[model samples]
Target: MSNLISGRLPAGVRPQSYTLDLFVQLAEKTFSGRLLISLKVEKSLQTITLHALDLIVTETQLCGQEALVSIHPSDETMTLTFPETIPPGEQQLSLAFSGKLNQQMRGLYATEVQGETFAFTQFEATDARRMFPCFDEPAIKARFKVSLNVPTHLTALSNMPIVEEKKVGNLKKVTFDETPLMSTYLLAVAIARLEKREIRVGETAVAVWTLAEQVSLGSFALKVTQAVLPLLNDYFDLPCPTPKLDLVCVPDFAMGAMENWGAIFFRDACLLLDENRSSTATQRRVADVITHEIVHQWFGNLVTMHWWDDLWLNESFATWLACKIVDQWRPEWDFWLSFQEGKAVPLALDALENSRAIQADVKNAAEIEEMFDALTYEKGGACLRMIENFLGESVFREGIRRYIKQFQYQNASADDLWTTLERSSAQPLKKIAKDWFTRPGFPLIKIKTSGDTLKTLHLSQQRFTGKKTGTDLNPWIIPMTLKYEDDESIHEQHILMDKQEMDLTLPVQGSLKWIYGNASEAGFYRTAYEGRTAKALSEFAAKALHPIEKIGYLGDLWALSSRGDHPISVFMEALCHFRGDASRVLVSEICSYLEILSRQIVLPADHSRFAAFVDQQLTPLWKKCGWDADKDEDDEKRLVRADLLWALGSIAQDEEILSELPRRQTLYQARPHSIDASLVGTLIRLCALSDGGKRFDQFIEKLERSKTPEQRDHYLLALATFNKPALACKLIDLCLSNKMRAQDI
Candidate 1:
């Protein structure tokens, strides 16, 4: 582990000669208040003789950045006088500032969500510099001793476990358990009007806290947190580390959740739930998110990262671990399979795209947060699954044990992990590590059924291998898992297999049930089953497989379907088989593919036949869930269904439904304010074709001038297909020059 604190500094962190090291935070809030700062370097080692200290601070906000407000100098320490009545050398001095948080920014800033007022902190960026200063980088680890003073009723929380809580008059003061020295971003929390609940996970007492006003939502979070904790404790081979754990909801939060040692921060929907009518999707989300943050307490909070370049190593493991645990414990939810289609495939494609590489350093700060994209979360997880495949489960678990034991509470790089595994297994891991981490795309593993013997092989594009052979061949450290029907077995082994089209003999006889080439979904290799082997996987997915594999089964079909290489009937048959209670996102993705086929394939040949086939595909499913076109259901669900209806109605020429779409569009567009929704575009596009040029122009004018973030997506869609794409394009340009929201996604 390199220096998360002392490594390359961010912009403005280091000035020409002076340096600032941010440490220590004291929350002196009345209901709501904050502190932000960094310590500055004043005297040189050669000049001071380790005697007196002299430092200056400037561009300041609130308090000074010293560890203690007033420190008595020892015989070995130094002191300096201020140029002004209350100053010293302003150039290099420790500075800490305190203030009431601005609600708009949520953390250091404030945020207002729905109709209720809720305040929480989301200071992961340079805002931590604004909150409290000490070496702010992740590598610059330091033990944190945080103290808070709030209204007697306002509960105080931090990364550390609470050691003391005292009520003095109307104000309550709390001192927390000291945190293992860690980076700034990992230290998170929220202070507000709260209603809380608690449970015991083993010997540790854990709690769920949220806005008092959100009673039903907060209660649901309490259950999910309590249930997932013990299960994870068993799987990870680590007990819940903190004596007390806290999960708090901030509706206005920018990210889903922050792993703050004992205190984790989350967005509203993730931690808060509606008991009576929450959709199936909402329930699955609660599980996935809660499990994700809890795992981070071990992976991210305990074992850290040395630099931002390997940030994916942190996120990808948590993601894979989260979905895996959820699927094992709550198989009914079937969330991982859904993720395979909507999230994983798209990520693999993006990772292979011209602009991206699997492992690259942060070029500049402008795109750091934005860098947390599809590749980091999806493709990275797939790649790690591959690593598990090659290493073998028993050895892989041991490697993790050694890796974490060696680096607990300290930061680590990808190489640090690779070295640990090499030492543990006495095998050269560099070849496989380089192939997976240093490349730009995924690999295609081809499995064929030849006579009674099943043969397997590997293929990749020229760029990935950097090869000059006729087949552009180069060896890859392939980690593959296989599922076959003839054996009724799932081979979760890492095939350190190398070849330029070398065939392999297998133990299979009749057919193959499935092939998880990268066992445990670890690697980024996609499987291609030839002829009859593909048929058996479909049959297994059709009957025996659960939601996760069904989604993967559909994803495999869709990949082949989109390339126009697979037959439409075979694709349709696979879609027909996915009747499980998948996710709304999965259902929506499937519906989209069918509609795309109708518009691009079937419709052009014979419009009436296409319409009939689409109506056939959608009609039964339409009434099955969200076809309340008359608006007689939940708002969020209605909106989700409305998305599907627009596609169906537009293609079928259902003018009755399509004509009223503008009014529905207007209603959806009109939210808490104009900027609260992204529905304007689809509604506008449906109107464009339904009412021709007249309604299109009226809708166009509204978007042309509307300035809220609500209009951004609509404007973008309008920009994509309008009479003049450039007109919409230029307006987007203007908006770009204007401010953008951090929560637009």
Candidate 2:
């Protein structure tokens, strides 16, 4: 007991031996005197000697039908007991365990797509041990020399460049150029029977590896990076350093994408594309995510945090940096608004939930994985964006650069990140960061407007029981992006983060029409202005000053109304004004909220009034905009057609509307186009509404059988409409469980 070694397990991880027993009573058990294992590592001089000592393998998970593993330790070098069960191992294991060699994982994983097999590994922290035995901790950073015993027909790629490849027997031993000493997780390997599509982005050679069945999708994967990489290099003042960049799409990907240094692993949908079949939104989303993961090569993988608690340091910084580059890369996309609305809103929601805080830890790791939802990733990312808005870009970038350099090849906490910012600028960045990350919920400002004068007030979490009190104000250092309209004039405030109340005396400010809280992509909360402000936003959302602003306003209004904040009445009023001119996404959200409200409160008699408003609002757009209804089989025509049909179907049960489904279906097939997520969801709703699941399943069964992960995601949504909360939640749970693979959902 005196000589035993132990370390506290971080959240989301456990020690290899968690429950060790050491007592006289346990003497009968397998010998255990520390069972100390040591390893010597060198990147330049390829070698690793694992001194297994006496660590007995009890109830082993390794050495099954796939492969066998055993280790016999000696003073000279531990001999790996490899299994001859697999044919490749018989020939390859001798060289794979070549004394001057190593193995690593993470950032990429290769698998068989169709008949083509590829090698890809995701070795984040302890998982890297699966690839090869090592210290298997972030703190013990080391450069690795990898000697891969791959099949002769397949190509092996890793971080940095490939230095040599030689054939022996049926196996090819490929050695990679040495990488900088960094965490084990940054070590990536992608080997496949893949053809490469290469591009020169400055000094870096960008490559896309695709299996025969996926060559088409892989072609479009790097286009987004081809454009954004250069922009980011200029912005970050750090060129993409790896000699080669490779992206491989795996059919059975568990995560969206991994930012492996030099080699990246992506879900098929993220990398593959066909213009004829995909929607404009999907293209934009692809670009945005590409920007996000690529930036992580520098921010997350290249310079990573030491431990799981500081995971936010790597993730949130990358999350914000992606938005920063995306803004400059694709100005037309206005993806930042999506970050604010989609990312920030959920963070605020989760912070308000029972277990708040961006960096929450529980006794076990399974709990941590559960928290790794939209709130942790997206919303946490958005708050990081807000911090940048407060600190300014030059300061933020300098802070980031300094932080990376300071902690390069090591782990870092959120505090370490703020320390750089604090040193760079004379600001209390730690306090500012803590206020947002450690605190629960977002700041909501409630301002009262009167003619020619506006009385702005902070929205403290005060109980409103008739009598009012703005006394207990915890004024968030909020960067409120406000749009002040004076007559026909528009004024924008880029900075004004901390204030309980702002009193502005503008000439004839009479009844301020639209006052949004988040302002632009700068703020991190929703606006709650009902009377004239809501009316004005509803009227002006389509032609708003900025597309991003329009996106935010729509999201805020919808979320506030959906959670029963004000009333369903407000949504109806706002939808009436917004129906004619707005983004299709905005229109879709409004319709979603209206349907929920209709189900919850709107009586059958009250449905027509609200239903008519929906029809009138969406009609002009359906007629003139991209979402014109159709029954053609053409994918392009059907996508927009499906959206329009869903809007119509929501108002169905009306005899005339019910009769038009067959007509719409026919027209949709007339001009055949590929179906999309929204369209598929719409078709499902229509089928369920018309008691057409059996009929719907007839068409959908084939698609389901041949569906990719992305398509299967939509199938789960159709199942989500259980019409009962308990049942809907149960189905959601079922879909998430391991019983059904996430990709098959």
lDDT of each: 0.57, 0.56
Name the runs in model 2 displaced over 4 angstroms.
Answer: 1-119, 344-348, 351-353, 362-364, 449-452, 455-474, 494-514, 529-547, 550-565, 599-610, 626-642, 651-691, 694-701, 704-742
State the lDDT of candidate 1 residue by residue for 419-526, as single tens digits.
988887777887678876776665555565555444443333222211122232455657555544445544433355566354555555454445434333444555
- TM-score of structure candidate 1: 0.69
- Number of residue pairs clashing in candidate 2, backbone atoms closer than 3 angstroms, sequence gap of 3 or more or interchain: 41
Tens digits of per-residue lDDT for model 2, 334-445:
5565565466346345534353667765332344346556656776788877777777778877887787677765667777777888999778877777867776566555
Model 1 misplacement above 4 A: 1-107, 112-119, 151-153, 161-173, 342-348, 390-392, 422-429, 446-475, 484-494, 508-523, 528-557, 560-589, 596-608, 618-745
Q: Count the backbone clashes (under 3 Å) in each candidate.
A: 59, 41
